[model samples]
Target: MNSLYAMPGNEAFAELLSLHTGYQRRQLLLHHFPDSETLVRMAPPTPGGDAVIVCTLDRPDPKALPLMMAAATARELGAARVGLVAPYLAYMRQDKRFHPGEAISAKIFADWLGHTFDWLVTVDPHLHRYATLAEVYPNAAHVVHVASQLAVWIDAHVTMPLIVGPDQESAQWVTAVSNLLCAPSVVAHKERHGDRDVEILLPEMDKWRDHTPVLVDDIIASGETMVQTLRCLHARTSLPPVCVAVHGVFAEGALEGLLAEGAGLVVTSNSVITDTTQIDISKPVAEAMVSLCEANPTETARRTPA
Candidate 1:
């Protein structure tokens, strides 16, 4: 497959991509845009007739401009199709509008991306109530890759662990991991008390007492939920060794707070790279990309050359 890399100011992550993809170092295009002028100045001079893989982490306002420009450049370079491997997809958590006049950011973002690329691949996207990425990006071939690597990582490190879901919505992920590890699983019912305060109702500790309880959740935004759950768990009985989360957004001291709450080790995937624990999910991400490429050969051909 013809591929081009667009760096997003993260050398370690780019190196990880190279290592996992076996793509040559030179093939990865590194861009350092300190400002909009720098970004527009360093835009790819010409598309290289290859699928551009944008690799970036989460930022308050991510540099999506570069990726969008790169997609346009690739199309101009004669690429039949373009695909995005954004480990941390933005605007996904807001798939729907809760208040009047509130825009469906997820759909709008997906539409914006669809206009630029033919397909998108992301890890553990915050689909919320959406069933699939296809539902979100109906016009584009979208692949929502799960963080199965989390289970593998947990298996390798956590023994006889109890999988704890931060909320009812996370039951699917928690159950899947529990079954895979042959461990018990419990879901915590959480109620938002205020902006950052939450109350958690954990399962009876009869079976979970003294066992390593690994809280599993898709996204840990402000970490209020996880922190509250951890506090409640500690109050009920002895806390577990660590907590395992899929997407460690860890927005605003979430990681530090979790660590402070006696969390042994907070494990997460490279989806949203964090300093704590980033178990690589590149293999699954690549697999999802390959599947999309295969399934949408016609679309791929239109955007990328054979």
Candidate 2:
């Protein structure tokens, strides 16, 4: 009798999750005031039944407050347990303080979310420094790996794909997808100058001349890394390359820029709900939610960070 509630901008994904989990679906209504405050409301959740919130935290700053409010409202409305399903979790990149007097945003954000919800589910979080989500998120957190999903898409669409990781951070994902497809793979070397500036050096691809290159990564924000990789790739090979990522957080016309920079195609999971989101991740996400629901929230709360 759990009810899945979709926050604004996440209705379609929630509906899909509802179908997959056999959970009744509802919308968490939001009204924004002129001063930019969001008022959250929803139908009273079933007593003793779990209340699940479906949201993808891409541009997370604006959405975070409303999400916290919704969780609090759900508790007041009588739900026995409240959980969050954020497919593309944000604020995971800043796991440590890089400079003097800098706040470790990743830990701060994780702590905030941990205090808000009883349990959480997400797709591949950017774990550059942290080993896992549980390292930061205090409450019970489950990660739904989408390697099989990405591999299935590549196997179905691409022919003789040479899976390529744009940088060392992407090596894990690239290896997973390639192993699943039984395809050759390579990882590129990236030197980031700034947030908007990056340099890419692709490994010699003379051996993969006949194979189609498929660049895989976890998130595509500015798309500069992918664009630079495409430039390096086109200089060495004649075949047009394809780009695949889990979260398509395209900023400042990045998707159009990629296509214009000679990318043949760009695809991502439905985590961010872009036009390029062709892969469905609802099944795995739903399964994770169900698994979390089966566990006692009180036991999970015991694992909270000190």
Candidate 3:
């Protein structure tokens, strides 16, 4: 049996993963102390086959302790193998220390997960400086691309879609996705004044104003860029542009704010579980996990999710 364990926030995604791999759904009894210390309880046994932990690392601080406990406990409980499927991997943005005496969190987070789990599989992490996951993680690591899924979404929904990269960083993803959709793509120039304040300048759009602009990016953390870009799109076009992201790290009201800002569509992959987007990316995640487990089938405990 595949021992699949999931945090409370990840139960829905766990269900999807179980459906994909035909693994039994297991839940971890997660608790929080008054001082916010996390207390994790083993709700299911670590089966002999493979242990798969399905925890998308969004708002990850609180779940860190529980994940550590769960992984360690699974090892002690005789799991045949262990792996993690974190679709929306967090702490990947800060690869370097911009200021002195700051911790290189990306390296720390990578090492922590690398040490805890036998292997790691994620989808479209907010990778900035690092070229690949194997650079930081000593164990097996895999990344699932959702550009194909986003392309499928574009082909089914939008007509005459003009894919727009909100910033230069997003240009690569936008260009790749546009090629997948066989549509024209444009990259907007961005000037960041501060953490929350940003300015977006679009090039001449007289030829493509009628085309439905779809803003694409890897991650939408603060939603500042998307919101600002939405406002810019509203000023230029009569219809609101569709906003799509690989990881919907929509802080607080980012999704609602985008919709209220006259967004025609706001969708994200199943990498991050949210109410707005339901595009499934479980197939790739499952495949990555299966490959990871097959490679390292130690006498370990595997936690199947959901």
Candidate 4:
């Protein structure tokens, strides 16, 4: 038995999972915990003979107590194993400490949570320098699930377009989509002056002047970088179609600000819930779960660690 716990912020995502996995509604447990006390009080009576799967968003200072309590409850109730399914993983951007006083949040967070679950799964974590999920979750079986649905959406919608990676970090994403569509791509270098302030420099568009350009990035924080890139493209000549980001963490009106800056459309995966756009990633995510399940049948049979 699988007991899926869907936190308040992940209802839509849970519904998507159910649709794809064919997991019965009764198997899914939905609860709203505004605070730690609420979370403790709302904990399921018992998670007997079931593997607990937790789903929650990235909280600024995540309340780990609740997650721990849930895991403990699962163990107490004879759960075989526990796991986490996070579409938008938090504390991943700060995978390293640039300064002496800075903290390696990604490692710290992963280590802390590693004790609670046997497996960790997320969609396109912001790995900046790290190449694989193992670098972050060394203890748990880490599964990095990408939002391949975005490529299909772009192929169907975007017409006569040139894919652009906002920065070198986004080159992998740009390359993946461009290869899928057999389209050309370009990478733009960016410089950040301050929060929500950035500059983008792209090569002369003598060759790309006629083709529509679509900028792609992993995350859109303040939309400053993308806005700057769009402005730069506009100055040279008529700008191309628009931009798209994998994780639309559009902080503080970033989406509206990007649209106002002449961005025709902004697309993103439903990794994080947003108003502008949300390409469903259910099929891909479900496929990943199936693969993981098949890889380790013993994973389903093993008893919870005492």
Best by TM-score: 2
* Count of steric clashes across candidates, in order: 6, 0, 16, 0
Error of 1 at 306 (Å): 21
Global lDDT of each candidate: 0.69, 0.91, 0.81, 0.68
Quote model 3's TM-score.
Answer: 0.91
lDDT by residue (69-100, candidate 3, tens digit) is 88887767777666788998888877899889
lDDT for each residue of candidate 1 in 1-306, tens digit (9 for 90 to 100): 455465555455545655666543324443555653334223332333346465644763556666676666666656566677777778886787877899998898877767777777777777777888878674455455454677888889877788888888788889888887888888989887676888888878775687788888887778888888888787654655577776777778888899888788887776766776568776766666666645644554433222
How close is every model to the real structure, measured as TM-score? Answer: 0.86, 0.97, 0.91, 0.86
Q: 63 in model 4: Cα distance from truth in Å?
A: 5.0
Best by lDDT: 2
Q: How big is the positional error of residue 296 in model 1, measured in Å on the Cα after superposition?
A: 4.6
Residue-level lDDT of model 2, residues 58-158, one tens digit each, is 98988988998998889888888889999999899888989888889999998888888889999999998899998999889999999899999999999
After superposition, the stretches of candidate 2 with alpha carbons farther than 4 Å from their true spots are 302-306
Regions of model 4 farther than 4 Å from truth: 26-36, 40-56, 60-63, 145-147, 237-240, 297-306
Q: Alpha carbon lDDT of residue 85, candidate 1?
A: 70
Residue 209 lDDT in candidate 3: 78
Residue 102 in model 3: lDDT: 89
Backbone clashes in model 1, listed as residue pairs: 79-303, 80-302, 80-303, 80-304, 81-303, 81-304
Off by over 4 Å in 3: 32-38, 43-48, 296-306
